[model samples]
Target: MTDFAVAIRVYYEDTDFSGVVYHARYLHFFERGRTEALRACGVRHCELLQRAEPLVFAVRKMTVEWLAPARIDDLIEVRTRFVETRGARFLLEQEIRREGRLLARADVEAACMNRDGRPRRLPADVAGRLAARVRDETSRARSTGD
Candidate 1:
């Protein structure tokens, strides 16, 4: 599905001794953004896991770049986008920004797996929904040249 943006406030727990958000905390922000994006597309992780062919998504690889430090009390936005979709894998591009300046960027590759942790094809309906969302986003972008 098309990626979505989620806004978050940096909190004390997310920071390090230097008073800046811990490096690992950015991953948590990205995770929440992805989860909320999926929910917006009507795909709930728990509900998907309850299906006959239960599936879970796991990050296969990730490349992250830190451009700036975010501190507690900062209002940040996590923007996530699904860049590619394959048989049982997807690539996502995510960025964390504050006041229009990028703070961090990540390229994440994720795979869908069954309970046994083996790769599995996403359900046809799920794939269709995701594809439609992507197409809609593309069309909108084209129209707005965004």
Candidate 2:
């Protein structure tokens, strides 16, 4: 599987009193996917923080759509991809799927920021690698509007 694929199992802690996954948990899965995607491309958050530029990725905005609910014990996959890149900001499209069923999707815009929280341009090498992995995929088996 590509770096975009991250498998996560919903646990008791991820659920609400109803035994259904708490809405906020989906965002956590997406975050992991984004982090792993960068790692697969040879970039790491700690390394970025240690660089001379000393930067971190901060979510500037996010729009999430809930299509279905995932319950505890469900095996889910969070798929992530770069949708666009503009200067210090990049847009990511992510989805939570349970056995090929789309449960939720989100569009996240993140910015590279310095320790002082000032916007900083993404490192050239990092940006290039991210762009190389950029993709927009619609379901072949079922379509969810992008």
Candidate 3:
């Protein structure tokens, strides 16, 4: 939808000796963003695994840019946009920001996979739901100029 956002508070464990969030920790933040976004669309990972043909998602590729730093205790928002789905894969764009200031961003490609690790087309029902959510949000955003 417009962009699913989740607020997070930076913790000491997320920071390095320099008192800034460690680069790799940003990945974790982005992951949480993605998970929450899916949840917002009524898709839950646990439910996916319980389907008739169990399914899971795996990251195929990602590109990230770190534009600024977030220090311990800083509150940040992770915003995720589900770009599109292609074959067995889906694309997402995520940004980490603090008080409207861009901190980092990531573009992700993820694939749906069977338990055996072979790529599989996303379940039709799941894809439909995601598509509907995207469409609804797009219209909402357009109407509000968000």
Candidate 4:
């Protein structure tokens, strides 16, 4: 499957004392990719907030690897792939790449939650559509062996 990807420029503000991207900034980059991916797939966060349950997706767990550093002015691509979904949870695999080389990788587990902050199922129809899209992509990826 073709992973959802977003190009991000590492600016001066994204760097730390030594001029490399601050470690925590990578999380923001990953979030932006996921947000755009959902938008492209027809789920809008603003609309989600207007639902009866006023729902949102929240990251419950994540693991990240810092393989290399990104410096100011680096053009990084944040790529996201849906791994799976079960009940109120979803898993995404993401990577930060610079010039086709890996800078970092992360696996994130997200849970659907209501305004009250209690775990809840994602809107049924929305989840179904997203799941279908993910399945289609998975099939194509396997067929192409990419």
The C-alpha lDDT values of all candidates are 0.85, 0.85, 0.90, 0.88
- The model with the greatest TM-score is 4
Q: TM-scores of all models?
A: 0.92, 0.89, 0.92, 0.95
Compose the digit string of candidate 2's lDDT tens values, residues 1-146.
22278899999999999999999988889899999877987889999989987999999999999999999999999988776677999888888999999999988999999999999988899888877666323232134443
- By lDDT rank, best first, the candidates go 3, 4, 2, 1
TM-score of 4: 0.95
Error of 2 at 98 (Å): 0.4
Clashes of each: 0, 0, 0, 1
Q: Tens digit of lDDT per residue, candidate 4, span 1-146?
A: 24689999999999998899999999999999989888878889899999877999999999999999999999999988887878898888899999999999999999999988999987787788678767977888888887
lDDT of model 3 at position 9? 99
Question: Model 2: residues >4 Å from true position, as ranges?
Answer: 1-3, 135-146
- Between candidates 2 and 3, the one scoring higher on TM-score is 3
Q: After best superposition, candidate 1 residue 2: deviation in angstroms?
A: 8.7
Candidate 1 Cα errors over 4 Å, as ranges: 1-3
Model 1, 74-131: lDDT tens digits are 9999987767677888777889999889999999888889999999987777676666
lDDT, candidate 1, at 27: 92
Could you give the candidate ranking by TM-score, starting with the highest?
4, 3, 1, 2
Error of 3 at 105 (Å): 0.6
**Candidate 1 lDDT (Cα, 0 to 1):** 0.85
